[model samples]
Target: MIALTSPLLWYTARASGIVSLLLLTAVMALGVMTATRVGGRPMPRFAVAEVHRRIALMTMIFLVLHILTTVLDTYVHIGLLAALIPFTSAYKTVWVAFGSVAFDLLLAVTIASLLKQRISHAAWRAIHWLSYVSFPIAIIHVLMIGTDTRFPWMLLLVAGCVGTLFLAIAWRLWAHPRPDGALTAVPRRKGRPGTTATASTQHAPRGRKIASSGQTRKPR
Candidate 1:
């Protein structure tokens, strides 16, 4: 148990936590891109959305573990209450609070999602929209509170978020092409065999043919 409290262990836990958070953010972004419908064309694969959701859930799990381990470490003086409350940490109050706020939003979204079947569809949808809110909050939290924010790896993480969102928007526009009502009805050509009013009479059965005088003709 002492090993878990060591500085080395603490660093490892924080690293894992950051990576998990990044993964979750990417997954959630993918979900948003997939769910959007522009002009009636949807993203190609349902599996992509499912994978995103599942990976996010897993990320949350790892995050909880990361928090627990970090708080338990004797080297770091984070209190349990501080973990839940915003701007209450003895160390880095302002930046740490960002993480607290993000954590709360994430918890709310995860719980609501798990209970979706029990909740009304409208209510669930409204809460689900909060996932977008959580994503940016999480990003801000990492940017502000993360110990290695200045590192090259951290820069890559931020870039990944921007790149993925850009690609998603571009792909969405390309896939859904809308027509301008130009070809609603095809025009009929003149002098065609079946085009004129007389064509109906010409195609009538022999027994039911009408005479030129408008009387029905008897079968021969």
Candidate 2:
């Protein structure tokens, strides 16, 4: 017969899973903002990127805690191997498998990030894309097997996370509107009859050094 464990372990596992989800939500939203350069002079782009990294680290930590507690709790048959290998857990096999898959993807992403300097940029970016796939799988795992999902508050929390991430993506697409995410060019300005002026050319001060027709000259 399977031995029963203390309820504390169960509670801890549930709590850690919830916290991990919340942290993951924050990390995803911040990642979008970071990519889109949403921060202004006060926050700065680097600051936004740094915050995203810190929260992602926290999410991984809590995720580890959740897996450990679930394995230790004897209420279910989830073992250490079950935590890492998909479809191996006897309890809610499919749901647990989803969590395992998500974890594997997250682990890949984390390792790629840590070795970003050593790896080619294309490889790193490809690995990073797995994070987007992992996030939705993790959410599905939570909803499928989580006992708390029966509660209204838990459902609302999940909805909010999904909403926040979607909003961030929408803003990024709207502002960038390009695959490279470059800023749009400013409109050209008209100058004298035979000359063309752009925003840059119009702003030039008089007497700036220049070469025209192979002769050293200055702007009028």
Candidate 3:
């Protein structure tokens, strides 16, 4: 346990926590962009979605590192239980609880996304919305408990992240309004036989036939 008291661990915990927040903010922004189908001719929609997925993966990696380092750092004596359970940490109870809750929500959303193919779209979507709740709580957690937040540069970083996320959300809600007032995947256009060919055959007179070429001809 004494080995865990290294100053390196403390710095790693702080740096990883901050990076995780930044990555999570990017993920949220990209999610909003994907929902609104923001990328067009220059950047395809699929590319935006792919970027969102990759960034989300990176966010999870950094978050896990943050959690692990924080818990292992002997300076604070934060147990694994306190890391996972809300309102149980001896140090900064309320702020730690907020972090715990946000972690739980993000974990659920990640699991739901992984199993998205097996779950109902409604179920996946509902779980996914938890991200919105988790993010603000996470910001609160950082503001209340983070030691580095006192720095002006850190404050500006947080502000910029918050501003970017809000701008994306506002653009999504106002510029891309949907009938249900929810962000959803754009419906895909299904390919089908030529409209004119299908129409000509379906509406052919009783004595006429639709040739293979889709032209009307007298019955043989």
Compose the digit string of candidate 1's lDDT tens values, residues 1-220: 3533677668866787776776776766666555552222233345555677788788788777767776787676777788779988887787667777777777887888899889998998888777667666777777877777789988797778767765765665676523321111222235434233332333234645445633334355
lDDT of 3 at 52: 92
Model 2 residue 114 lDDT?
Answer: 100
- What C-alpha lDDT do the candidate models reach, one value each? 0.66, 0.82, 0.82
Q: On a 0 to 1 TM-score scale, where does candidate 1 land against the true structure? A: 0.68
Per-residue lDDT for 35-140 in model 3, tens only?
7666655666678888998999899899889999999988887889999999999988899999999999999999999999999999999999999999999999
Query: What's the CA RMSD of model 2 in angstroms?
Result: 7.2
At residue 8, give the lDDT of candidate 1.
69
- Model 2: which ten-residue window has the lowest total lDDT? 177-186
Between prediction 1 and prediction 2, the one with superior lDDT is 2
Better of 1 and 3 by TM-score: 3
Which 10-residue window of candidate 1 scores lowest in summed lDDT?
179-188
- Regions more than 4 Å wrong, model 2: 1-4, 177-220
